[model samples]
Target: RRTVRAIAVACMLTSATTAVGLASLVVSKTVMLRHFGLTSGLGVMVSYVVIITFVPAVLTWVTPPKREEVRRERTSMFTKVSNGLVARLLRWRWAVLVATDLFTVGAGYVASGITVDHALLDQFDETDPVYTTTLLIEEKLAGVRPLEVVLVSTEEDHFMDPEMVQTIQKIRNWAALRPEIIRTSSYGDMLRESYVLLSGDPSVRSENFKSAKQVKGLVTMMSQRDPSPLNDWLTQDGKKARVQFKLRDVGAQATMRFLDALEQEIESELGDDETVSVSFTGEAYTASRGQAAVVNDLLGSLLVAVVVIFLLLAFFFRSVRLGLLSIPPNLIPLVATMAYMVWREIPLNVSTVIIFSISLGLAVNGTIHVLARFREEMHTGIGREAALVRAARGTGRAIVISCVTLMAGFSVLLLSSFVPVRNFGELIAITIGGCLVATLLVLPPLLSVAGGDGGVRDSSD
Candidate 1:
């Protein structure tokens, strides 16, 4: 009962802060992130209720450990180190703060340079069978990804017109020059090839046909493949034409550049008229678009988490300055990890960008635990230095032990064959390590700077 009472306020504070951080995800534009935020936030609150209610009732049936055993634990190496750490930190508060500020500013600068991108094969390692087989398929198949440019016109039988046929050839020629596009095929290009073959005149072309009826004759005379008919590229009534291009194995940034350039070339061919509306659609194109949304949604989530957590901390401590102090310990871990990711060339992708939310929630939980203990100790009329030392020893062992256990749990992700998952695990482990050090070394000295005079002075002085 004493133990539970001692931790009850801190426990509630941790749960409230964690749940609020997760609740910010409700504003995410992506459905997956929204659901993740909702369910996970609810889960955190539910667990908090269970811990406070169920554990206390069960404790009545359990036996307490001997006082001697508890005393021995307090004298252990972790406890001794935690006390020694604060003793040294209280001696050089401003120096520690300056060093931490310098590191965070440098890290933030480097992290700002990270480019948002998407790559289909980036999930797998190069030596993996999935990756190797995909490369072989791209080699033999003239590229496996499809990007379709659908052209629509209000005019009936528009695609069969000679002017439209010439326009398509210009677009095809543009596509052929792009290294990202391995092959370009469409109804007009195929008909043009067939016209040159059948007419026995080297001057014959799709534009030479000059009429819809003449173009239809060439389409009818062409030998249809066993599966897809040539009409697939040309819709009935001839109002729309599907120009399919097989895209090369390229990253999202390269694909986006190609798409942007293609849009310009298309405008140059068709001119500023709604007569023919062009749109890009297909597997590769849709994935590229979705990657952009992921970057936007995750960055929004990160902002929301920060704001909600700051408010929650201020409310818990009942002081704005205490709330403001929480920012450095929590924010710096994310900054340092992101800087490490930039150095390692890890792009913000599906699995990796989530590191901020997970690590920040955890960082807040640990930091608040120590801060809560410091407040409790000060309430007993001890000086700031003495209170800090007591809080460090009181909460340090559990915080370090919990963080080490989490690091081990996350390390399991490193065993995954998927590269993104492995990187996520690796970066998360680094962040947790950062959080542990910050909670012990950085946060305590910074708290001493907060103006609060307890009734007693430090005995060591």
Candidate 2:
């Protein structure tokens, strides 16, 4: 009965702590993450209700009391092993502390190397149809992605002004010459083709328009022809012109860099042109900005989660030291998971980055359960060492069982076809396993040494 009550209390506390971290993701700008956060938070609440209410009710109704006692005694081997391990750990607590510090330092070093990956193409396997099709398009057609440069004129038909036309032509020429650019097209191309046709000389180019009147005449003549495509490139008022730069399918970071450099060049070439201004918009630009937003949200969510969990622990235990002790066990799993990513050269993307908050929330469960049992044992008038051993024996098996169940649940994600989803599942499983080890092995000794009287009996007593 005592063990069952302790388990119920611990499970409820674990659910609350985990929900705090998951709830923080509700503020993310990404729609997918927002949905994930809400669903996961609800799932935690539902699981807690079921574990506390349904499981206990079923045990009470179906299982006889005498059989329950016999079953518990049959599990005595696990308790004995746990008690022996905790006894050994408490005796060598200093060595354990040193080893933990060294491991944490190494993990922290590796974690520092983790980087955000902005590439959309890298999300899938090379043999994926999307990947192969994109490659084929880059090789055969005008690239798969378009980087648009919109040139705005201060007045109507200003696109016909010789200086404006020259600036547009220069920008197009610059883009066309770049190896990364597969092709370039604009109203400038149409103007050049019309000029050659009108002059009856293939050598004549559109830049040959020496005066504003000539440029206007060329635009007027083209307007007479079917202008559906022309309307897309030029605004109805002729006040805006767009140059479409078809770029080879470069990854997100490289694409952003290219756009930045091109914008700078446009500024330098069209210096102080009060009549014209330029801006950029395209699929590549949107994706780059989205990646940045995700990174910011990830960092913010992590900070909020840590603060919330810390406060919750403090409030639950009514002891600041116990609350502080909760941090290292939870953090070890998160940091070690990131270190594993660094060692494996995995880039932190939209899906993988959320693992930090999720792991933090889940990892603290074992720590809370162990601490709750330790406090219960101390309240029975036992010495600190005996309480620690008893707590480990009574609670350690439950923590291990819970962690294994959670890991198995998350591990099912490995079957997902998406690489990010698979990686998320694998990393989360590792994180739960790491948390189990930290909670069972590392946390008990720390509590024995630092947690004086196990927060039950005062020193004056």
Give residue 361's lDDT in candidate 1 (0 to 100). Answer: 78
Cα lDDT of candidate 2 equals: 0.81
In the predicted model 2, the residue pairs found to clash are none
Which digits, one per residue and each the tens of the lDDT, describe model 1 over residues 1-461?
78888888888888877776676677877787789888988899899999899999998898888999899998988888777878889899999999999999999999998878767678798899988888887888876689999999898888888778778878988898988988888787678777888877767663456787888777666635554366678865779899988888798888889999999999998886678899999987888877878877877878888888888777667766777888888888888988988999898876787778867876688888877788778878778889889988888888988899989999999999888889888998999899888888898898898725321232113
Q: How many clashes in each structure?
A: 0, 0
Off-target runs (Cα >4 Å) in candidate 1 are 200-213, 219-228, 451-461
**Candidate 2, 272-293: lDDT as tens digits:** 8787888888876777656767
lDDT of 1 at 219: 61
- TM-score computed on alpha carbons, candidate 2: 0.90
- Candidate lDDT scores, in order, read 0.82, 0.81
TM-score of each: 0.91, 0.90
